[model samples]
Target: MSCPFAQSPRSTPNRIPKRSSSERDSIYEVIDAAPLCHVGFTQQEQPFVIPTLHARSGDTLLFHGSTQSRLLQAIASGRPICCVFTLLDGIVAARSAMHHSMNYRSVVAFGTGRLLEDEALRQQAFRLTTEKLLPGRWETCRQPNEAEAKATAIAALMIEEATLKQRSGGPNDIESDLSGPFWAGVLPIQTVIGKPIPADDLPPGVEIPSRIASLTTSG
Candidate 1:
């Protein structure tokens, strides 16, 4: 199905509208690929934007943090929230300086948060957030205890409206600059998983999990 978010002045891009989309799959793709997102909210007439990990459970986005955290408290109060996810793909090198740009995929979502009071639902959010960071990680690590669970808070945001904006391929340069002396091409960027290092206190004979090892090869 197409995106449920209708085009509004706030959600729509005023410039280069061709690069913007409101498609459901496109929006989800960007959100799922991003490792983290910035959540913006206003409290006491002051605005704040905090970066935090997030996960998608169907159309609802999940955020978790310490229950005592100011950001989490603000979010759980049912305040308006704006969440953004971004992935930088490459640096576009154009013949002219003004034509230079970065290739990226980004999403802007509008929602209001609701605290997950039910223990079962909060536990599910924990699992989803963990798996979102590293597949199979939730099963590999020790589960949270009652005290740990109580200390953590999970906030659910039902996406009310959203938009996806993306740019790809080479730079857009003027015709005259195409034959310029400068080299123009994309400097590809990627997120690579490096060798995993064991903890200093890790006991002997302990080995890295297969799922963790696979990230280096897969990336």
Candidate 2:
């Protein structure tokens, strides 16, 4: 079968990437590496965007949430879906207000989601969740019990269409405005890992793992 998330040779009129060419290959790589996504689906004709813990198994996204959430219900009811993940690295400043911008990477995935019912698959999804938060965590922690597994719902979304848009480098001001009096540059921002705060119930000699302690920064 043709790659679902790959660029279409056919015409697209309502597309968002009219100004920039879509980076399809790089986007799939990033989506596979990223840990979470903001998934949006409509409920009663109203919009809803939910920050969800997810895993990308190739082109499929595994999203698990409370069994009773409306978003899950909407997905089950056949609403079209979009999952977005953005990494904002910095703010780009320009000489003029009109040229202000941000240096970032983001992916928008368009797909329809179906609730996953296989018990084994649900357990694997939960395991993927722990691994996403901390590599190698699935083996270290106690596996989910039967009751816990049944209480949660796991859904898989097959990405039918996707795109990536990136804006980087210097300001895009007109030639005449390049020499404007206002200062202009990018103010970079990133995620920093703070010192570990151990759980209150930890024993006196418990220590944090090296894998977690080494996460110095992220975007």
* Model 1 lDDT per residue over 1-219, tens place: 764676678799888999998888889999999999999999899999999999999889999999888788887898888999999999999999898999999999988888999988999999999999998899899989999998899999988889999999998899988887999999999998898878999999988888888888543
In order of listing, the candidates' clash counts read 0, 0
In terms of TM-score, the best-performing candidate is 1
Which parts of model 2 are misplaced by more than 4 Å? 1-24, 33-35, 217-219
Residues 52-86 of candidate 2 have per-residue lDDT tens digits of: 77787667788777899776766655567888888
Q: Could you give me the TM-score of model 1 versus the true structure?
A: 0.96
User: Could you tell me how far off, in angstroms, the CA of residue 48 lies in candidate 2 after the best superposition?
Assistant: 1.4
Off by over 4 Å in 1: none
The estimated TM-scores of all candidates read 0.96, 0.86
RMSD of every candidate to native, in Å, equals: 1.3, 3.3
Q: Looking at model 2, which ten-residue stretch has the lowest summed lDDT?
A: 10-19
